[model samples]
Target: MRVTITLLAAIFFTAVSYAQVAHNNLFTVGIGAGLIGGLYDGNYPYSSLKQHGNFGLGAPDKLDGELVVFQGRIYQTQHSGKTFPVDDRQLTPFAMVNFFKADKKIAINSALNKEGLLHLLDSVLTNVNGMYAIHISGKFNYIKTRAFPPVKAHDHTPLAAMLPLQHFFEFNNVQGDLIGYRLPSFMDNTNISGYHFHFLAAQKDAGGHIIDVKAENITIEIDVLDSYTVHVPPSRDFEQFDFKKNRAEDIKSVERGDKKQ
Candidate 1:
């Protein structure tokens, strides 16, 4: 009997442990953005703006339309530390594109293995008349910092170092809008939120070099999908309605009878 009881207890503990582990892995989707700031020297034209949207994770693969669209814009200015300015007379025209993958591993591995993708990104930058960089690999967290030119004459090492803590930035005369969100129901329990990615683009010189490098203000957004479990608040113990009266109702009846008497 003692041995049987011990075995049953062990089974119960194992089941409870398994349940806790399962509960901790519930998937969630997160969204965020990054902003850039700076002043334009007379030699260049500059305008500040904000980026926003939802980022995806999991089996069905959610959509981060805003990030996908504005990534290049952010990457060029922030990651490369290059200045993107409009012509003195012309407005700074903006363009955006969206990229998607069925899963994070596939996205990272494909970027690593496929030369075409890299070339495609390069082509996009070449046409932009600005500085830009793209790096997709190893669950989106891996940033190829070496791919772009250094932030001109600026000490951005502090911002770069803080990236692991979250995205960081530096510049003068900066301000803008930034926001983010996470929806758990989108991804079907595949633990997809750990990955990260961004593409940045900004105005540059005829030689595709950034000029008068400076960031005014920056807006940053980050979306983490499948990063961890979400806890559902426990249900409340609401009182049930009864058709039949109990003691409280009975007391009311007695009071009515006393009034009638």
Candidate 2:
């Protein structure tokens, strides 16, 4: 009958729509700009994140600390530079994840500082506008990292206000992993552009958001993720937060880690 044919057509179209949406390589809960505005209240649990990807990074709810996912385990590096295993019940306000499938792997033994390393990796990417996940493992000549203390988000405390409270740590001749992503320029508001990484020492004792680094004799893995899928947080704070203001400079300043180290 005509009605049966119409129902079948509807189902077919719905299936196609889901297929198109699920194709994006990157899956993120909330946007990066929310952090700039202090929207740090979310209920997205680490268990849910584990289901999405094993290699990614983000922050825990209430700006508790730096959240890093390496290999298949999730670790929370606190402000004191101590790492702890994150429970499945623990939640994150913002995070980026992907089912990583490496497109290429490169070996570099030449001495390179953070800037140099970033430049070298940048040169490897032929498409400047493309998004890619980068994994660097091996010895680090020197590395500096920092983590934010747990700041109450319900009170509307801006991230800038919590800047002075961040704790920094430095290590030399250490073994660790740097997990992160390099996104396109157009995703400024949607997410952070350029390279962003979080460090976790091999001992699983110390790590945080990477501020600077110097490395040699390391294997760098690159996974190209061309598209992204964002899941908006359903929290009341997220729904009410004002996102109209431009926070590009704020984001850049924070990312640059310009403070005396």
Candidate 3:
């Protein structure tokens, strides 16, 4: 009886371990470097991207506007701070997505800025080397965001050159949700190393890339990813493009809207 019980226990433990490892996965199309280097052509359509995951962020074809996938519905936030539903036929040049299932929840009782918020998350982070999907929703005392305007289709101009033309906005006491990821440093070329968040304002009508924020009395949901896969486009342009150049500074400027150093 003791031997039989031991065998059954081993089987149960093995099953649980396998399930935990396969529970979370991250799917991404195109690399962050491609977005900054002007490989802005559409690689995947919204219809196909939906199959990978339901919650994430990216840019529409031609880098027209900021793309946010929330609750299985896709939205585009234009320079006007107005959000609109995206067509299934619309394509994306760069996107990161995952079927989000919260692994834990943390509630805050004090106001915190972007840096402070990171510190709070880091304090309880399960693994600093693992990727985490974060969802923070509620009223924000203050938040600032930015969005890029549409450019000509297949325009070869690097995204950095357009930062001066990007529009910025600030909101006070805004009700919204922030969808983003906290990636490990090893993922530098594949995605933003730290945090890359997009905001959805109250009623889901306004949003863009979150530049800054202050929050209090809100819940933060975190999902630790177990695996991540990158799908590099199979295009002649991508084939000949150089991925070796250290464009880290340029990429940061594109993401933060900072002037090129």
Candidate 4:
């Protein structure tokens, strides 16, 4: 009788542990091959909006528009500075999402620039090496954002070649949210290691990948990730691309948006 009771208890504990682990995993569609290879076509299978979290970020298939998953609804902002609801069935080449339940919240009192703010966030993390899902909501003194249009069908353009084609926008005294991730340095090969963020204006008329930001009196919420999953593309190009070479310079250029439109 005692053996039977212990067996049941062991089974119960194992089931609970598995459930907890499943809840903490972050879901991703596609790898960072696009960053190195510039093969921007979205090849990953389309995942349902219902499967992901209330807040997420991704660009569309073939690198069409910037996607912001706000309040459980997916919105796509194009280079024309227009925002539209994305169909749930739409696919993405790269995306990271989780059920954004904030584990901590911090309020910014001073007007810190983007670099300063990122430093502050880094200081607050208990484990600097751990992954975090970051969401900031409030008023921004000014923000610079950009979105890319889909590449020409006949063009073999890579991301570095497409930066000059992106549309840039600047907003002053705007209210909205920035959604993204902070990954460890070791994860650089698989993702944007430091901080990657996208902006969506509260008015829903403007949004895109964040180039720069200045804000005060904002609430920054963070979800310390316990798990991460990456889905690779099925394309042969991605499989054969040379990720061994360091493309940090190229990525830095894209992030800076140094090319004048």
Q: Which residue pairs clash in candidate 2?
A: none
Question: What Cα-based lDDT does every candidate model obtain?
Answer: 0.24, 0.84, 0.85, 0.78
Positional deviation of residue 48's Cα in model 4 after best superposition, in angstroms: 3.2
lDDT tens digits, residues 108-212, model 4? 878989988888887887686898989999999999998888864323365767777889989999999999888787777677677889898888878999999
Error in Å for residue 35 of model 3: 0.6
User: How many residue pairs clash (N, CA or C atoms closer than 3 angstroms) in each of the candidate models, in the order given?
Assistant: 33, 0, 0, 0
Query: Which stretch of 10 consecutive residues in model 3 shows the poorest summed lDDT?
Result: 17-26
TM values, all candidates? 0.18, 0.89, 0.89, 0.87
Residues 139-258, model 2: lDDT tens digits = 999999988888765756767666778888999999989999999889886889989999999998988888889997899989887678788988788888888888777677667654
Task: For residues 8-75, write the lDDT of model 3, one tens digit per residue.
Answer: 99999999886565447788899888788888888799998888888999988887669998898889
Give the Cα error of residue 174 in candidate 1, in Å: 25
Report the alpha-carbon TM-score of model 4 versus the true structure: 0.87
Query: Positional deviation of 225 in candidate 2, in angstroms?
Result: 0.6
Off-target runs (Cα >4 Å) in candidate 2 are 1-24, 259-261
Superposed Cα RMSD, model 4: 3.1
